[model samples]
Target: MIRGRHQEPAGERESGLADEAEGFLLAHAHRDQARREAEELCAGMPWLTTAQAEELTGHYVRRRLDVTRDLLLTTALRAGQLRQEYEARYAGLRRALLKRHAAGVCAVLVCVGGASALACLLAR
Candidate 1:
């Protein structure tokens, strides 16, 4: 039977010894479960103490928090990088096209001015 595979949020409760995994954790685990698991693991071993159990429990909680923080930091970093890339692309498109529009307008104005000047000379 499986004992240690990660369970999904919805179906974790049902993945038991049937999975053929070793060292598998229970789904919907809690702090009390942690203490119970610690108790079970240390039942036959002589090296651990009450203080050690508390320390181990605290360590587990801290490690979970650390992993969560790392995931959030990674997601934030990726989002920031994507935002910067999009902004850069938009800025480049704006820069490339803006001057062309202005140049077209200026060219039209110059053509009209030259036509007016020619008409005035012809009338002279």
Candidate 2:
């Protein structure tokens, strides 16, 4: 029960984990896109129009800055941290999905082998 409401029973745990993992991957990708888009919007703004940049920052950013370089460095670090977290979460979910699927497949193969052996003994 790593999460609630979406958690699956042992029988189908792999598929459920896969689904959840895939969802987060897609969401993370979208988050990455949004981040890039935001940066592009800032870069594309006219430097002559400091008002537009200020206006954009007013709405889209909230970092306090006594100096431009410090603010830029801090914000960049924050973004990097966010990216790392997104990638880490995605990897974690992917691993969970794979582990669950492997367990499930093993269980199924065991059941199938047991049934086949029983059938052969019955026929002989």
Each model's TM-score? 0.47, 0.44
Alpha-carbon local distance difference test for all models = 0.71, 0.73
Error of 2 at 92 (Å): 1.5
lDDT of 1 at 75: 95
lDDT of 2 at 100: 100
Which tens-of-lDDT digit does each residue in 1-124 have in candidate 1?
4589865655554565445353232222444465566566666666878788668767766565566568768999999999999999999999879989899999999999999999999999
Q: Which one is best on TM-score?
A: 1
Q: Model 1 clash pairs?
A: 1-20, 1-21, 2-19, 2-20, 2-21, 3-21, 3-22, 3-24, 4-24
Residue 63 of model 2: what lDDT?
31
Off by over 4 Å in 1: 1-59
Model 2, residue pairs in steric clash: none
| Segments in model 2 whose C-alpha atoms lie over 4 Å from true places | 1-66
Question: For candidate 1, which ten residues in a row score worst on lDDT?
Answer: 20-29
Model 1, backbone clash pairs (residues 3+ apart or across chains), number: 9
